[model samples]
Target: MTTRRFFIKTTSLASAALFVKPGALHFKDAHIGLQLYTVRNAMGKDPAGTLAKVASIGYNSVEGATYTGTENFYGLDAKSFAALLKQNGLIMPSSHYRLGEDQENGKDLMGTILHDWDKAVDDAKTAGIKYMVCAWLSPAERGNADHYKLLAERLNKAGETCAKAGIQLCYHNHDFEFTQDNGQLPYDILLSHADKNLVKFELDLYWVNKAGHDPVALFNANPGRFPLWHVKDMDNTPQHAFTEVGNGVIDFKTIFKGADKAGLKYFFVEQDITPGDPFISITKSIDYIKKNLI
Candidate 1:
C-alpha cells in the first residue's frame, strides 16, 4: 500500500450533491472521524497536514491505524498529539492495534509475541486513546469456533486491563467473521463469549455487506453492543468493489435509524482503495453523511 493509496480505495464517484433538510436529520453529539489507514501515506509524510485535511473536511475525530512503529504517533507522543488535535479542532479517541499476536501466521512476528501487555496498556494510556482494538484476525485463527472462544477469552483479559485505565478494548471485523462454521457465524461466537462491559464491536459496513448479511440486522440483534462503525460504501456491481459513501447501495440513513439501538458513539470513514482521487471520495462521503445521516 503506497502512502496515498493507503489513505483509501481507488473507487470513483460522480460529482453530485444532495440537499437534505438539516433539522430533519438526527445529529448526535458524537462527531464523525476518519480511519488514518485510508490516508497512511499522507499521515506518514506529514501527520499534521493530513490531520489538518481530515479536520478541514468537517470530521472532528479520528481512529489511528498504526503508531508509526514508535510509542509515539507520527513523532508526536500522546501529549503532543493531543495538543495537535486540540489545536486543529479535532480529537483522537481510538486506535486499531495488532493484538495478542504479532503476525496472523501464528509466528512471533514484529520481533516479538506482543508479550508486553503492561507496556501496551501504558503506551495506550500515554496516547490518551480511550479504545484499543484488535483490528483483525487472520484465517489461521479462524480454524474453528473453539479458537474464537479462546481468542474471546484472551480479548476479555486485555479488555479487563484496559478497563482499569478507563479505556475500552474493542474488535474490528472483516468479511471472514460471518463465515459459517457448523451453521454458526464466528462473529456470534466472539460476541457471545466476550465480556460485554470490557469489550465492544467496531462494525465495518463494507465487510458486513460483503459477508452477505445486513448490518442493520446485526445492530438489531445485539443492540448497544456496537459502539463504533466503519462507514464505507460498496460498488453497485459486486461485493469487493469500493465506491464513495452515498453513491453505492448501502442505506446509511436506515442504518443511522438504528444508531440509538446500536449504541453508536463514533463513526469513521474508510476506503481500502479508490477509483479516483481519495480526497474527492472522502469529501463526498463526508458531505453525504452530514447531509443525510448526521
Candidate 2:
C-alpha cells in the first residue's frame, strides 16, 4: 500500500508539470503569495495537504508561521520541505518567529535576547527562506520607548547574524507599534536606530491603517526598506470589521502601484479572523488580487 506521503510526492510532481495553454492564466507583474495562517484550520489538520490546496489556489509561494510544531513541516525536515515546495511550484520566502523568551522564566519578554535563534536561522536557510522575522512584540516589550530601543538593539544583533547567513532579519508590526511614547512612535524609533543593513520590516497594511496611518505615505518616507508585507482588509462599516479582500476599505491598487518603491519583494494575504469559512475567504482574496492587483 502506498503511504500518504508517497502519494502526495507523486501527485506534487505531476501537478508541477501540468501545462497552461496560451492565455490560460496570467500572473501579476508582482507575484502574489499566501500566508498559510490564513487557512489555519486546514493547516492544523494536514500540513502537506494544506500546501497542496494552496498550490491548487494558484499560489506560487507561501509565508510560514509557528514553525515549532506540525511534525516539523510534514516530517520532511528543512531540506525536504524546500524540495516539496519546489516540487509544487512553490517557494517559501519568509517565516514569522516569536521574539526572544525571558531567561528567568520561559515566557517571551524584553528581559532577554534569543541566544539560540541561530539554530532556527540555520534551519531557515535549509528551507530556502531569506527573511527571519519577529511576528509580534509582547505587551511588556511594548510598554515604553526605552523598551522598544532595547528591542531594537536585540533585533540589530539578530539582523547582523542573518546578514552573515545571506538572510535578513525583519520586524512585523501590529497596531500597537504606533502608540506614542513621549510624542514619538516606537516603530519610528525602531526604524531610525536599528542597523539599516541588518534590519528590514514587514509592513502590515491593515494594522497600519488601524493605527491611523497611510501605507503609501510610509513607503514614501522610507523608500526600499520594506521587503515583505501583510495584505489584509477591513470592513467599511462603523465597527471596521475584518472582511474578505476587495470587500473592504483598503485601497490596494494605490498601494500595489507603489510596491517597487516600497521595496516589497513578497506579500501574503492574511486575516486575523474570518467572519465565515476561511477557505472561502482565502479563495476570494486570491481572486481579488488576480483580478485587480495583478
Task: Specify the highest-TM-score model's number.
Answer: 1
Off by over 4 Å in 2: 1-30, 68-71, 74-76, 102-113
Total clashes for model 2: 0
TM-score of 1: 0.85
Give per-residue CA lDDT, model 2, range 27-139, as digits (tens). Answer: 22234578878887787677778888888876777898756422255456788888888877788889887775432256333312374666778888999999888887666
Query: Which pairs in model 2 have colliding backbones?
Result: none
Tens-place lDDT per residue, model 1, 183-245, is 888899988999988889999999998888888888888888888889999888844587889
Return the TM-score for each candidate structure: 0.85, 0.85
Any idea what lDDT model 2 has? 0.77
Candidate 2 has a TM-score of: 0.85
Clashes of each: 11, 0
**Cα RMSD, each candidate:** 8.0, 7.3
Report how far off residue 280 is in candidate 1 (Å). Answer: 1.5
